[model samples]
Target: MYADVTVVGAGPVGLVLAAELALSGVTVQVLERLAEPETSMKAGGINVPTAEALDRRGLLPAAERVHRETMERMGAAFGRKAGAGAGAAATPSDGRGAGAQRQMTGHFAGMVIDAGLVDWDDPDLAAHAAVAGARMVPQRELEGLLATHVERLGVPVRRGVEVTGFEDTGDGVLVSTTAGAIRTGWLVGCDGGHSTVRRLAGIDFPGTDAELTGRVAVVDMADSSVLDEGWVWSSRGAYRRGPQPGRVFTVEFDAARRDDAENAGTRPHRGAPAEPVTLEEMQASLRRVSGTDVTLTALHGAATRWSDNTRQAATYRSGRVLLAGDAAHVHSPFGGQGLNLGVGDAMNLGWKLGAVVAGWAPEGLLDTYDTERRPLGAWVLDWTRAQAGVMRGDAKSVALREIVAELLATRSGATYAVKKISGVTQRVEVPGDHPLAGRHAPDIRLADGSRLANHSHAGGFMLLDRTPDGAFARAAATWAGRVRSVPDGTDAAGAARAEPAGVLVRPDGVVAWAADEAEATPTAVTALEAALHRWAGAPAHEPVA
Candidate 1:
C-alpha cells in the first residue's frame, strides 16, 4: 500500500499528526504495535498550548467532556465531592479564591504553582485570556478521542502492525513491518522513547543519565492512613498521596548508586525495566520513600516506572524519515511537560511536512520544523533536569527547594512560572519586529462576532485584515488558494489593544506577519506579499474562486 505519510505509533501525538496531515489533504495512516490501547496512567493533564491546539481543531469540546467524565470517576473513587483534592489548593494570600486555583496549570518538581497568583493582566499573558486553560485528561482518553477524530478524517489505524524496520529512499520510504511492507512519501516516528524507527534511522539521542527512579500505581492498601494526603519530601525521597484514591507515587534517589554498582562507570539504565512491577516491589518502594509500611494488597492495572533521564534528538529529520513526540525527546514526567512538548512538535511539524508532500512548501520550509522545535525540546530537557535537581533528597536540594518555594509564592515568580508551564510564553523565531509576530495569535473576535479560532478549524493559513478598505486582503489575493482572507471586519477589541491593522496567521496559529498602521500602505502591502511568498510559497497562477 502507498500513503503520503505513515505514522508509527497510535498515541495522542501520532493521532494528532495524522489528523493534521489529513486535514491538509495528505493521505495518512497510523500503525500501532499493540492490538489495544494500554490502560497505564500517563500525563494526567495537558498544558495551555496543547489545549489551544485542540481548540483550533474543534477537538477541545470532546476532550473537555472526557476530562469531566474522568474527574467524576476519580471523585467517586475518592468518595469526595467532585473535583475535590484533584490539584493544588489556592494560597489565602493570592486572593483569587477557589475558582482560579482549580485550573492547575503545572508544578515544578512536586511544588504545585498556584494559578491564583498568575498575573493575567500582564500584557505578555493577554493572549491566553481568550483561550481555555489547562485541563486534566488522562493519556488513554485523549488517545481515544484523537483516534475517533482520525478515523472520521478517513485515516486508517492498523493495529498489531509493528514497524520492524524501514529504508528512506531519496523520494519515499519503504517500511517493513510484522504485518507486511508499505511504501510512503514520509515516515514519522511518534513512538515512545526507545523508538524502533529512530534507532533504524540512526538518529543521535544524546543527553543525561538517570538520577532517580519513580513508580506510580493504583493499589488497594490494607492501611492507607499512614501516608500523607499530598506530596511529602523526606530524607530518603518523596511520595504523593491521592489525586485519586488508591493512586500512589514514590520516587527514590538511588539511581546513581545502583548505576555505580551495575555499570561500574558507564551510563545508568536510561529507561524502565522490561519486567513487570510486582506487588512486593511496590510495597518496598512505598516503604522506602514514605517511611511507612503501607501494605499493597493488589495492583489495579499495570504499574509504570520512570526516571529523570532527559534526552533530545540531535535533529528531528533524516531524508524521508522524521521524528515527533516522545520519539524526538524524553524526560521525567515532572511539570507534565512530556506530552505537551510532543503535541507541540506535532503541531509545528505537521503542517510543514504536509506542505512538503503537497508540493507547495517553500525552500527550506521543512528545516524550520527542527530550527523552531528542537530548541523548545532542549529547553524542556533542561527544565525537567532542573526539577530533578531540586527534587533530590540531598540537603542541598532541600535548601534549593525551599528557595524555589519562596519564589513561587510571589506574584512575579508565579506569573513567570505559570507562563513557562502553560506554554503561553513560547515564541517562534520568525523574522518580524511586531509584538505579535512569531507568537501564537490571540483569539481575536472579528466584527461578525466570530473568533479567530473559528476560522482556523480548516487547517490553513489566514490573513485577518482589519484595514478599513480591505487593503491587506486585496494584496494577499495572489496566494488566496493557500491562505484564507477574512476582510471587511474590524477586530472587536483590537482597537482597544492597539493591535495591528492586518495579521497573517499560520495553520498552527502562529503570527507570521503583522501591520501596525491603521491602513495598509504600499510598503506594508509589499511586506505582506513577501511574507506570503516566504510562508505560503509562490502565489497560485490563478486566483482561487
Candidate 2:
C-alpha cells in the first residue's frame, strides 16, 4: 500500500485531515485534480470554532497574520482604517461605551446580527469570551497556510492527480488515479460538492434544488457611483457593494434553473453554475437585483455564480470509503458557513480516522464521526435554507425578513444567533452530563502560563486535571501514550465551571468527559477510564520507562 489513507482533494479539509493522520503516526497522501491551488475568493472569513481549531494546531499565528493582511487590503479598498487586530474588539464609531461596538458576528439573509447585544456576563457564552472571535481570512490564503502545514508534516499532496475510480474491497481500497492505481486502507473524498469520489463510491446525496442565482465578483465598472454601498434590498432582489471597492454581490430570486432531466435525483449543478462567470452576466445580474443600469466593464479576478443548492450525504462513510468537507455536505455560502463547516468536518473526522488507521481505535470509534458530524451538517443546510427563504424578493419573504430582523435585534435573539454562528453552542453527544462535555474545551491556562491548546499541537488527547491531589492525572496514566496529562492548569480563562475537577479533551478539542467533583472519586475514575477506552482507545497496559 502506498499509504494507509488516501485523501482526494488538497483543499483545507484534506490537508488538515492528512496532517492529523501524519501526526497520529499513520501514513496518508492527498490527491488534487487542480494543478495549482485556486486563487478565487470563496469564504471571506472563519467563525470562532474554526479559529480555535487552528489555534489548537498551532496555526493560529499564521492565520492571524493572513487575516490582518486581508483586513488591511479590505480596509484600503473600502477607504477605512483597519481594526487593531484580526480578533480585537472594535470601538464603535458612535462611542457607545465598552460593549456597544457593532460586533459583525454574521448576517442572516441580508439582516446583520450584532453579537455585541449578547450578554457577556452570561455563563453560557463564557467559552466564546475566553477565545479569539471570528476572523476575515481569504480562502486562498488559508489554503496556502494548510498546504504549508501538511508539507511540514511530510504528507505528500500530489496535484494534477485525479481519482478516476476506486474499489473498496472491505479490507482496503484500490484507488485508480490519473497517475496510476494505488492501494490504501481508507479513501476520504473532500473533493467538493460535485465529487467524483462520492459518485464512484455510490453514496446517496439528497437535498433541495436551487431557487436563486447569486453572483459575486471584483470588476471594473464604467460608473461605480450608480450603485449604493453596503446592502441594498429591493423588490426585485438584493445587491451589496463596498465592503471593498469594485467587489459587488447580487442575488436574484427565482433566477436559477431547477435540476435538469439528466441531473435530476443526483448531485446537480445547482451550487456554482458550470459555466465561467462573465462581465455581461455580472452586469445583467447587478442591473436586475439593484434595479440600476450599472455596467461592469472588465472582470478583475475570478467571478463566481452560486445558488442555494443545499444537500447532505445520506452517509458520510461507505465501508472503507468515507467523505468529509463539501464532499459530505453542501449548501449556500450564506452565513459564511461552507469553509467553517468543512474545517469542522476535518477536525471532527481526522483524529478518529487516524486512530483507526493507526490500529488502536476502539470498536465502532470510526462510526462516531458520522453520527456526530452529520447532524451538524444537516443543521448548516437548514440554517442556509432559512436564510434563503428570508432573502427572496416576494412580499411574504419580506414580511418574514422583517420579523426575523426584529427578533435578531433583541438581546436574546442576537445572543442565540451569535452563539450558533460562532459555534460556541455546538456540542456532540458524549458520556458525561457536564456542560463542557462533548463541546470544544476552553483554552484553560496552566500554572506555567501555557494553555491546553499548547499541549494539543502534537495531536493527542489532553487530560486537564485541576484537582489538588492530581487524582485525575494518576487515573489517566494507563492511556499516557495517547492522552497527555496536564495536572497543573489554573483555568485562568475562567471558561470552565468551578466544580469540574478535570476534563478529558479529545484530540479534535471536543471534551470527551468532564468531572465536577473537587477530588476524583472511584466512580469519577471509572468514568474517566471508560471515556479513555471509548475515545483514546484501550490503555497502553505498560508502565512508562
**Per-model TM-score versus the true fold:** 0.91, 0.92
* lDDT (10s digit) by residue, model 1, range 1-545: 78999999888889889999998899999998888887665777777678778778877667666656666777787786555553522122111122423455567788877667777676666655443322666777787888888988999999899888888888899999998999999999987787778788988877778878888888999988888877899989999877766888888888643322112111111132345667898899999988887888999887777777777887899898999988888877878888888888898988999999889999999999999998889999888889889998888999999999999988899888888887878888987788888888775656665667777788899898878778888888888667899873444555423456789999888899998887778988988988898999988766657
Model 2 quality (TM-score): 0.92
lDDT of each: 0.78, 0.78
* Tens-digit lDDT string for candidate 2 (1-545): 38999999888888888888898998999998988777554777787778778888888667667756666676676666665422233332111123312344667786776565766555555544333422666677788889889999999989899889988998999989899999999999988888788888888888888888788888888899998777789888899885655788888877576644322211212132366788898999899887878878899887777778788988999999988988888778888888888888888888898888778999999999999998898999999999889988789989999999999999988878877877877889998788898898865656666666877899889898887778888878888779889876345554433546788989888999988887678998889988988888878876465
Which residue pairs collide in model 1, if any? none
Ten contiguous residues minimizing lDDT sum, candidate 1 = 261-270
Off by over 4 Å in 2: 84-102, 130-134, 259-273, 489-499, 543-545
